[model samples]
Target: MAFTRRGILLGMGAAGGLIAAWALTPRQFAPPLHPGEGEYAFDAWLKIGKDGVVSVAVPDLEMGQGITTLIPQIVAMELGADWRQMAVEPAPVSGAYGNPVLAARWSQLWLPMLSGLADAPDGLLTRRMAENDAFVVTADGTSLAAHELAARAAAAGARAVLAQAAAAKWGVEWEECEAQDGFILHGRKRLPFAALLDAAADYSPPDPPVLRAMAPQERAADMPPGAQLHFVRLDLPSKVDGSHTFASDVRLPDMVHAAIRHGPIGAVRLGTFDAARAKGMPGFIKTVAGPHWLAAVADNWWSAEQALARIAPQFAVGDRADSKAIGAALRKALRSGAADRVATVGDPDTWLKSKFDHVALYTIAPALHAGVETASATARFENGRLELWAASQAPQALRLAAAAALDLAPGDVTFYPVAAGGSFDARLDSDHALEAALIAKDVGRPVQLTWSRWQEHLAGRPRAPSQAVLSARTAPDGSLVALGLRLAMPSSTRELGGRLFDQRSGKDALFLQSSSDRLAGEGLIPPYGIANLKIEHVPVEIGLPTTRMRGNSHAIGAFLVETFIDELAQRARREPLSYRMTMLAGDQRLAACLQRAATLAQWGGGGAGSGQGLACWKMQLDDRIGRIAVVASARRDDRGLRVDTLTAVVDIGRIVNVDIARQQIEGGLLFGMGLASGSSTSYAGGLPTTSRLGMLGLPQLADCPEVLVDFIEAGGEPFDPGELGAVVAPPAIANALFSAGSVRLHHLPLTAEQA
Candidate 1:
């Protein structure tokens, strides 16, 4: 959910996206506050009960991403509790608990407004796109500010909880006793959390709690030995036992179910449909209709679904609905030279005027998240305050959107993050959450709204299709002289509200003047030392809505950039691995990872039908660097190319939980394997053309290659490991395809015919 580069651009920070603007603004650090309590509340995240149970309110929703467990581990590790004593629940949506890393970058985007230049066109555009500080839990991976904020908050809460317990037990100074192992130790006496809870009920902690180390460390002579750096996931037992309450499981008194049948994105409704047929169905209560929206409310989910199925909703299809036509438009836009320049170095225009050694135009098909779980939200609006429960990565965004729909302040709504069946990027701005809020408000009852798999597929924002024309010019000595990249794609940066531009009000007016080139060209620029480089983006507005996909344009952009670099090596008659090493001369971290991956995969050892390919990249997230390298081995046959093995070496700075990091790498690699091999989307008549699961061509476990993941710490604080494997997988696989055979693929999915 936090992983969309807006797709392909997921983890790649705007290399030079807004460096000048960022430099102009001072960094803002809005730390969260500690909430005092009744009901055992210690802060916005952690709580302790008289029974000695520790509950942590995680801001991010768990979608089988292990975050539910990861968060509990973080809280318990600092709070000195046994695994059995720890519990995790959803935190209220608020900017106070927003992900710092995402907040930092998002704040940069609003520099024009932050600098008080709102009257200017640039400032106005930025202001419109970034109207509210919508707290997002998905950005910065799990290691960045999102998880960092949660961990720090938990540590602080633990210190306070322990301090208060110590003060209450022996009537001693809070600082006199140290806490560990679920007990407050003062001299030779110990007070358990259960016994201290009563006296500490009204205790107020210091502004910031004096926290202890989470992982094992050498402690002062006065304190107990720190805990070990391992955790037994807390949610696993509940998940296995079916005791976990997912969003779909939420049930309130008199709660009714609502099913949605939304029209295709960007389509216009020509007329309204009569609900007579649907109303006749059993359990049918009411029908709601809006522009490009339709919903049926009934006693049960099945009946609501059936009711929707019976009604036929229609929309006037737009011209941009055709996939082939959209692709053609993108290509045309790329050739037009009317675009925005994202990154520029040296004199690329002068170099482009001279001779070029290699040139290629690569295209990638639009892809889908196609997660196992469909989008769902449950809402109950009683009185003025509205409550929403949803599988959202950005709960604050849902609150703001819902509040806007109801014309209320953000404080009027309270959002609870729920367990998602699966949320890739689908929960960024859940339409269902808004729909549920509206339905519940209108019906004057609690309502749970869910989208059918088919409707979800058709209405979901897909990864935008992309085309890049890359040209490289080499000097007489074979050193690269100039590298130029011209990319064309629909705007992925503009949020949901940007779509409805009301010029009269001048609220969304910036949508008309702005180009979403910033998001479209994210990670498209190279981090390597290319003396003369030019990266430009042609913003083509395809009518279809696009959201962040994992690796957001970076996956496809990396595929194009890495494969093209390989092509340049082939043109120069130099080995691909050697060429990459030469290009990455000064970057020791990336170089080390690359060399390690090559050594592990036994690069250049492939012979006959076997081929080994290598690709490496540096992901810049704000000030941090996430370096990764991958080597893929494959065999080509008449049927297609079979990926035999993939060896990856990653340097995400320090390691937090090795198990979770390893899982992220392996899972990310498998996800990339699916995108590189298949799992693409097509469109027609303003809707997804491919509806069935079989047509999508997702890679199963059988399709996953044997992946060997290795971690290489560069000796720094812990960094983000969320999108490392996902970002590196596609390009490495593409490079492997090139090595496997003379047939080079310039498009995605490396179809059977292409293979």
Candidate 2:
């Protein structure tokens, strides 16, 4: 029999203080089973047992992104386990799953791109962006910068170092202090890591943990003993048949379901619902309200949904006027002078005067993350306590929000997280689970509230659409002299009050300062080295509540940047490849990737019916380089243009497993393009027009071009570029479409006509 434990569920009212103590009880944990704890259970587990599994905590959701498979491998490799004998479970609610050293390293090559958008003199911020690719050292906010954490890991090698010390004192060489099966061992004499756990926990980690990269001699041996990166090959019985679990399907004796509808955005409406009417209904128990009205204690979800539909709200948009009207207001907001200037390199107006012969005002649009599954959460208030099961990308955020709303201390609420269907970027803004908790708490009953597809489409966070204006001019020699760009729209994340980009300081503030060396504003100039170049962001907040879609909003920004570069190349009568190399005179890796992608795509060998386009990017994060090249191809038919296939060549240093890394790059391509696919998101009212996957204009799989990915590992150095979420794919396809034809597409998602 399998058992799960929950302590301190309730307490007597007479001894009210006892309830408080129970609510605040120290969290229970099941540490990783020592190699001897079991002739059964897992092969390995690590660090925090608060999650009851052998895996690292995940900060983001596992939506379609393959993080579920990738993150566990990192810790398992470090923890010394045969991952094949281990299981990947989402850690409870912790931030330990993050590896800033690697993440910050990848950020260097990218942050510079965002920094170049600053309106500073001579692209001063461009240099900062390049310098702090992973994170800003002195910037404010949550320090969610993964790079800073990397420094801590390296500096705090305290745990590893102590283990080495203990081994050294035991008369064995530190090198012989092999961390085996979570034990510091010397021949037959071994000490379980748990024996030293208490000692290791007290010491402060390194100021900047001195991380020793896994030596080349050690990496091949580091594959968790019997572990091979072939788990993906062992087909799961669930996948091929498309089987999955939705949180609403849970069954408990006397368990019930619910369907909740939230008030329109920004304005909360509390209504005087009729309990008498609902009492007569089959599944109705009672209705209550805190944030929104909820009809709780349902016999069945269907009956509850029916009673909910009958309830009427007594409130309307006051001062905050209309939800529908917000869209229109956003468009007008774009034209308002309140727009902030995010980036300004040179005197763009003066540069345009001397260099640009003409300018093209291209319209770049906004988008959304319409994950196939709608949001859902189930909560039950049994005996003065609350228990919740939810599918949330940010479990910690959701848990905190629920505790705050319920006036319950965070520990009073027990959150049981379910496997998420998908949490594209914006899934972090959790209103779904909180609402469900409120309803269940009100009636003292268990309720599982699910949003309708339409409700999700309108209420869920939609990626804000944007617009950009580009100007390009050529000198008599056909050398590109000036490229001036402006984001006609605003950013979802505001620029920090510092010199470059500022990260929002949340729970992980201090964690981000570690990797500030690789930052942004490096340069907008490609290898061609034209004298004047500029890119600017004109900030315009829609005032409507928005959520992050995935990776960073910068994901879409790369597409715009790459597409514009392609256009500049075409206008100058230069191969995009040659044009990029000239711009990257000082960037050998980027130049090399550009050459590699072109070669793989057979750039110049195209026939009349088929065409190819190329794009390159450099992520100079944490003093490491993660360069990528995108080569896309398509065929022109009498009926319409069709993308036949795409090929991506990436150099994410120290390719842990070529197969897994290849899968990630390929997955990024699909996700990056899905936004504009004809079947998915639609942009209207200066926002994503639709938040329904069925509605977003993404093309079908039949319409999806075949993709082939190849990796050129930068060995000797072990650098992981797991942050490829929003960077390479879109720019690659956009460039390919631009190559297939003369017209340039500045807006995403690339439309068929644009192709």
Candidate 3:
């Protein structure tokens, strides 16, 4: 049986509601691993594979997102076992491998609307209410997210089952033989998990074990930490080998190397080729319809690439929309754009007519997603089935797409993942996987399409270049009375493949689909106290759209909101830090973050060559708050301005790893700065300018700055940190530019004039 929900609401990360539609189950006692052996499954399974080693099958792609690191910790916490002795596996694709929390948050349009503080909106209340039923909890169901709830439920339930099995064997009451530390204990007699497994190997499994909910009051009194506990240790190492295998390091028997002369225009392909020129070349394969005029099948890649150099790629360029024409069109679209009411306040018409303060004009820069690893996928069609070796962040989507395209059952396709060189928000969606499948069909063997540095720059998914305008009206009391904001961003719906949202479905009985009514989110606004405020979002369609660049819309929105606050401080002749704190009167975390970042960056002191500045933001997802301070160091060189050091402070509530989280935050700042400074991508028509990495002028090791990361790891709450990398950089850097250059730069990719 199968159930479907077209579109679903989403929260922060993907959690419950997605189940793998595995066809394998214990009919009598055991089943094989695969088709003939038994059946194929995509279930999130925790197996103690006879070796006494615990392995959990998770579905998310590692792509340097820390999913592998975090999921097992949650499992360890719940299983009450060894965290260091467990192994993490990328669970197979099916209903079980889906990240449902991702679906729910997507349903909510990935809104980062500061939910932890007071005066939360109705939508949050509704979501929290939904969490209780869908999540694991006794009363009002939703407290912790689905993953956390699942761990506790699975652990507690399994304990009860073990206790019953022991009771049956010893002829005692289940309660009398209480389960303790992954074992059954009765009056000092104990049975370890492995021993119990051996004893009950042939028994039929019972309904998920019964468990008495640990209420708040009974936790300390009924069970102390040391009173009875068994901790799980994960069994895994860093898996490090000094020698590495990148996409560039691939080689296999009968494998062929290919080079593409890409389409000069968007939505166009290579229609013709120069085969006659390559007829005399060795190792030359037939010229295909695409960019590769001729593929060279050889024992190695170098020989093929060398032979390919002799062949000329036929230039059959299609209708071209030059960069100039595209930029003009988008700008014109912005000029006469219709205003939308994203935020409302006490009649903005009254405030616009009676504004007592000055106006603030700000513009953001266009940035590219120069992820270290370019798009690469290898596919092979063998026997009656197909196998794929891909490095993808959205692996589940790739599996579904490949199956649909190849006319094969989802099970017919197998996805093998490799360690990601690194992903900086560019691996979300594309026809790359599809393209790999296409080439492999023609070659009739495994083919690896490794994008060169140039190809990645020219065809890579770049962050949509965006712009914002801020206008503020102030009262005599030095407070913002009315504010107006107009922003532009790429259409978010383009990613959903025109699918509609449907929340009500029987997916829980089928593939564990999370119920959410939204699939695409756009135009998000936070609660800012200002009278007569008007905010609107324009669906600006520039060239190649890449919305999944790390922080998504939250990153862009934070930049605009935070920068406008800085503009207000300058206008009011108040310190930027103090001014922002005033706006966040009731928010202690936000207020504290602003203070901390300023204090760390020495906000009031003279900067490297300029002066001090402060920047801060509160992410709606997971209630993440971060602050930034940058001291720009620029010398009189013939070149443009360069920064010396960038410092940041963050408070992500409950952190799982201080080291990993800090590294990400610091890296994110540099990533953001790289875009702000050197990187470049643009729109040539409705299509985005996919610049290759080599052409992007993004920062390299030569220009890297010193970054310091400080964290506020509050022990009171347990929550995942929300988008930390790029959130604090813009505000902090913009402030630095203001101090160093005294220009209050509005646009990003800060020009020599702005810098």
lDDT of 1 by residue, 243-347 (tens): 887888888999999988766645356356778878678899988875567888999989988877787766564543678777777878888848888888999
Tens-digit lDDT track of model 3 for 85-185 = 56676554443333334434443432324323212212434334323222111110011232443334444433444455677778887668665445578
Error of 2 at 79 (Å): 4.5
Arrange candidates, best lDDT first. 1, 3, 2
Q: What is the Cα-based TM-score of model 3?
A: 0.76
After aligning candidate 1 to the native by TM-score, how far in Å is the CA of 112 from where it should be? 5.0
Cα lDDT tens digits for candidate 2, 100-203? 33223333323535533542312434324322231212111112223223222421242355465466558665555555555566777776554553344333
**CA lDDT, candidate 3, residue 92:** 49
lDDT of 2 at 393: 50
- Name the best candidate (by lDDT): 1
lDDT score, residue 370, model 1?
80
Model 2, 749: alpha-carbon shift in Å?
2.9
